[model samples]
Target: MAEFESPIVMPKLITFLSSLLQRAAESNDINQSHQSQKISVFHGLSRPSISIQSYLERIFKYASCSPSCYIVAYVYLDRFTQRQPALPINSFNVHRLLITSVMIAAKFMDDLYYNNACYAQVGGISTTEMNFLEVDFLFGLGFNLNVTPTTFYKYCSYLERGMMMLQPQINMSESSLYMGISSKLHLSFNEDESSQSHHQQQQLAV
Candidate 1:
């Protein structure tokens, strides 16, 4: 099995993931798809002022979970969005959704991770709120937290392809990078997911 990636890779992963998410949320904001959307547990009364990249950076720097947790958390978010298509990833709810997703992913994927209270602190919400988010999110996911190796590989492959597709306008102002994923998840991929441990540090995405 391949060894885990060096800790040096975390920042780049964080940066790349942030850019992709920011773009997704912005696109959703423009669509404003669910104008009559009922307030779900993930929605905030108002959108947060913090940019998506900065919010993700705060979680990465503070949550400090294994590098793979970021990717796993992203998978969780995709699942959640699929499970609840009415509630897309928009600016208003993205911050809370991020904290909740990352927290759950860290718990499921990491042997050692901070508690909900700690995650809440990092996410600028109360521990009670974090707890609520977790429960609601789990139920939203129908309690499916286990990410199969095949599924993980498929996501990584698609993200890399998406990055390649969007490679033109990529500013990459920061030296850091990690990878891409989706707001649009229906795309097909030709990668062989029948390879590698999901926990192994992958060169493609975290």
Candidate 2:
């Protein structure tokens, strides 16, 4: 079982993640790539007004999952996009994708965690819709949820690099410690994926 890293102690990681996602959401919003790419269930009719950073902080404050779950969730989203290149993370669908990915990551990483209805409430979506997303996410990823140690470190390095892009002066070696990846990859993905995210497969991880 994966040990949980409480949210209270992970404000830095949360902020770093929020920054990266904020950039992606804003850039994707301007481009609106769905016209050229494949659209999936995650494309909302209207983009939610809340900023991606605020929404992510809300999830961090409320969902109470471990910090590493955020990283693991990123990995899941990246894999999902790799397999389903059509639906990248745009503003239209980032929140739903985020909540579902975090919730599923929580299920796989934490021995004790929230149920679907509770997660649905936190995610600001109906339980029915959350349930639908869960199944579709699993299918979209083809149940390839397990992450090897190598893959886990790869993602941690990727995230650190992304953070470095936003903060160029930061040293890469120190950035790893700054992002708090100095420790082991705290993850265990037994459950299948459940979420939304996109871009070209190459841009998926942000």
Candidate 3:
């Protein structure tokens, strides 16, 4: 059975971030080419660091988890990266890593148990791949599982309340406005000042 890991220590996190930044700078100079090259650059730099953050953001956007849970997940990912220097940080692998980390973290903080099959389906990886990665991830994290963040429940509750408050204002059937908000939340495209102003005008009309 998989177990929950302890929260990552601080000094290790700092070291990991430092290394990640250095790698990101090096990746920026490399010319983009094939998928492998892109993966190499991301693994060496951006994806490792950003994946945790992005994953946390995505989970919080949908789940009622606290920012603290996300923070703990970030810390775990960072520490694990520091210790497992060989782990890939490319787009594909980074996503896999993030999913694995979050699953472990949820168990630690929320007392939730996530199955490999769910992770495989969402991550588009085979169950064998997920199992392999999970083992590698567990080893990287030092088997110190015992994380219990204080904020996840509270944040989730707050989000629920906020959504409830907004429900009356949102017409679920209206695709355009719903799409606009969703786009903004996902940072899919840039919204300039004029766009923001226009959105405000539209809101006032409603």
Selected candidate, larger TM-score, 1 vs 3: 1
Candidate 1 displacement at residue 169 in angstroms:
15
Residue range with the least summed lDDT across 10 consecutive positions in model 3: 1-10
Query: Candidate 1: which stretches are off by over 4 Å?
Result: 1-8, 33-36, 161-206
Evaluated against the true structure, the overall lDDT of model 1 is 0.68
Root-mean-square deviation of candidate 2: 5.7
TM-scores of all candidate predictions against the true structure: 0.73, 0.75, 0.43
Residue pairs clashing, model 1: 12-177, 12-178, 13-178
lDDT of 3 by residue, 127-152 (tens): 88778777777887797454322122
In terms of lDDT, which candidate is stronger, 1 or 3?
1
Per-model lDDT? 0.68, 0.68, 0.42
TM-score, prediction 1: 0.73
Colliding pairs, model 3? 4-145, 4-146, 5-145, 5-146, 6-144, 6-145, 6-146, 43-89, 64-156, 66-152
lDDT score, candidate 2, position 121: 90
User: What local lDDT does model 1 show for residue 13?
Assistant: 54
Q: Give the local distance difference test score of model 3.
A: 0.42
Per-residue lDDT of model 2, residues 68-170, tens digit only = 6787787777777677766767888888888888988888776678888988898788999999888888898787667655455556665656555665674
